[model samples]
Target: MNNHLLRAALDAAERGWHVFPLRPGSKRPALHGEERCPRTGECASGHRKWEERATTDPARIHRAWCGRPFNVGIATGPSGLLVIDLDMPKNNSSSDTPSGVTTFKALCERAGQRVPTTRTVRTASGGMHLYFTAPPGVRLTNTAGTLAPLVDTRAGGGYVVAPGSITPGGSYVVVDDRPVAPLPGWLCEALQGPRRTPQPGPVPLATSASRYAAAALRNETQAVATAADGTRNHTLLRAARALGRLIATGDLTRAEVEEALSRAAAGNATQPERYYDDVIRRGLDWSIAHNSPRRPA
Candidate 1:
């Protein structure tokens, strides 16, 4: 057994990340298969999958890596991690294929936000993984293309091969040593989505500026709710853009507008909430930028 592999496993465990062994030079788990389970040890109760068997126990780490130079795999869900995968396109020969890094930067620009700086890993295949701690009380699942093309996230029910793992392609290595950052609130909002709850009923209001804005919101919310299947995202964007004016002028808060639009769009949603979220966020950002408050004339 390679001492380096053992050390790597120990290092990950010390950081409080639950880890399991991967087959040497591969991403697949090295743990026993249920079909061939001896029905002993950890599986005595039942066959625990690799995720369940993952541990931060030093003794377990040493014992597991003693027989072979197994690669390390981090169970992101158990570790409270959300890793954003920024990938290089497989067919790099095509100019049209954008790298994950590029698309994610464009997404940040669209949201009028900066790309977060955090601990990062360079994958064996030359991709980047930005590590973040998931917010408390929010359990997110693995996502594919929820952010942008060639980008994915690993959270609950997904795992990431730890740095020091090697494969035929190359070795995973840490590029940034910074501590993992908390998942951004905007991102959490995008992935977790608006809480599913009963919609509020109509209430009478005075004919004021806020009332007009509220009426517009109600009308556009209805438009989005009744949008045709093929036009849901488009309708969501338009509605958000219209409501953003109220958000900018203090007639409404961005939070309320977001909640309103998200709730309205949820009924007609065909794509993942993240996709609709991206649409609404983009529209609101555009409106805010173009309709910034002016100084007294």
Candidate 2:
């Protein structure tokens, strides 16, 4: 990636993208002579004496893995650091359109609270990453996760923001709160509104929507399982799927779902069995509520 692309990745990171340091030799156009690890700060594996000069500096290592000019950083507040990733939509042009910009602006306005410097990181797929410094006492988990439907932090505190990924024309902006950009009251209200929870109510499991929900639950089960093994990709994917299922079903109580999810993550029991139990219990409850004959006085 070029400087522009690197800057884009930075912007995306700021917006809560799960930025990972690429390993060397994984470069598409293989690094010719020498290489180094981006994270470990070590010489590239199996370097010959002739290749020493080619692979020593951090910049070269980053270039080798990233194949671009960028690094990922999170907004570490007085509390902790937040790692993020951008999940861009399939269409790339969405970022450059008016609606895209408006959405991006709205998200920044909502998150712009006592932030200072903003930096942009470019991504491999012609996108941008944005970063901003958080203020004292503000927690990344508190702000990033609660700001869902707009942004979310996965299990390990990484977030994936929409419309800001490598999708055509997708871009991110790091707004410095210290400068105090004028923001709409409604945007603030949306950001400050109480967090929404999954509603526990009777739902028609036989409908098309319920079928989709069941599939989603299965996907979530797989994701959680993969995450248990310490794989980043599956963990993030599972979290997203699970969140979608919760939104779609609207039948399982949030508390129950959360408890089930927590148990699944613990990996003490077989996930599929546990998941089946939870879903079946939910269905049984729904049936009891909907099908039971009314009591006569």
List TM-score per model, in order: 0.68, 0.26
Q: Rate the local accuracy (lDDT) of all candidates.
A: 0.87, 0.38
Compose the digit string of candidate 1's lDDT tens values, residues 42-155. Answer: 999889989899999999999999989999999999999999999888964587788899999998899999999999999988999999999999879999898898899999
For model 1, the superposed segments whose C-alpha errors exceed 4 Å read 194-197, 200-297
Q: Report the C-alpha lDDT of model 2 over 1-297, residue by residue, as the tens digit.
A: 444444544543444333333222131222233445343234335443211222223443345335544233222222123322233344655564433223455566677743223344444443333433333343334344344332323222333222222333334333322332222333334444644333223322333345556555455544554453346334533454454345434644444444444444444333455554454345435544554456799
RMSD of 1: 12.1
The residue-level lDDT of candidate 1 at 53 comes to 95
